[model samples]
Target: MKILFVEDEATIAETTIPAFQKQGFPVDHVETVRDAEAALSVYDYDLILLDRVLPDGDGLDLLAALRRAKDATPVILMSSIRHSVAERISGLDRGADDYITKPFDRDELISRARSILRRPAAMSRRVIEIANVVMDIEARSLIVGGTAIRVARRELSLLEQLLGARGRIVPREAIERNCYGFDDEVSVNAIDVSLHRLRKALVDAGARIAIVTVRGIGYMVEETV
Candidate 1:
């Protein structure tokens, strides 16, 4: 998804840009609120990561302006200073979707952003993240540790079923039904062959996830951690 990261702190912007880009999320960084306002006119973003403090004005002002213009872009507000419950409530009351205090975990920040984006009316995507690996169903590709790996169509379909189960055993019959229609002829070991190829591709791409067999049952996919 496209994201506008409006952060005035040089160090923070420098540190965050690459980290988000590494995960296949497109991030554009800007320092001042004036520049941020201009950017909003030029581009459309799935979300805005707005810092509370800005060089020219308060980030809240820009957020307020956006709301006044009837912009529906989701925003996650961030601040270096601690915010009291009332202050946080005030920010949300003003139109921000989520508030994040400084010195937060980068992963947690991304997780929160993803959670906000995953809301029904916000960002529409069918995606699953396990470790650093991101399965983009719409893209029909797997992003493993920031690198996009080309996947066969059939393999992509198979991976989705396993990942959606969240480590629970997904029956082979279920997988077959998903990968092939009812009329398609199936080999006795077709599923096994497809799983092997998918496994090999994940390894070659350095994904930190694995699909494991349940011996007497089906298969489960889990993060390598």
Candidate 2:
């Protein structure tokens, strides 16, 4: 999962980012609301971890604006002001999908993140579309411009990781974690080989989307002419 964490606290930022990364989620963070908006404008994220109070602005206002724009990305509000039922309701009413008190369980939070990522619309759906190419998740099928294309399971797994990142650049380690699990033998060449196959399959299918490799970084999938 690709996530944006909007918080100003240094200690919290340092601790949470690594913890979430350890759980296989790639995260980008900003200390102020303005930076958060800039991040949102430039990139797509699967989930947002927003703090209610910020140094520059209220996180609720950001949540409201995103909802007003019809952005349905899941948001989990974190706040110390979650003392009253009214406060809780206000946060939820403003558009947060979930809310957690300031002091939270890391394991529980990780589980919640996993659950949110595994939403029905994101998971159960057989096909995922990016530009003209559609990935049939269940059948391991790939269709581009109405033509069917075959792909290897590992290639499909890599595709799913890219899709799940919601267009953000996903790192090689994250690709390994999600695509292969803890038990599988992971190698740098493994990811490279699978991605090469995926790219070839998409090109062979006349796909309108291409996976762009960010050298010394990661990969992002985007529409192509």
For model 1, give the RMSD to the true fold: 14.4
lDDT of 2 at 112: 78
Report the C-alpha lDDT of model 1 over 1-225, residue by residue, as the tens digit.
Answer: 567899988888777766765555556678889988887887667789999988898899899999999998999999887478887888899999999988778888888887887788653456778787788654456788898888666677788778767779998877765565322477999888889999999999888888999887899988886
What's the lDDT for all of these models?
0.80, 0.78
| Candidate no. 1 TM-score | 0.58
* Model 1: lDDT to the true structure: 0.80
lDDT of 2 by residue, 126-148 (tens): 46887887776544566779888
Output the number of the TM-score-best candidate: 2
In model 1, where do residues sit more than 4 Å from their true spots? 123-225
How far off is residue 155 in model 1, in Å? 18
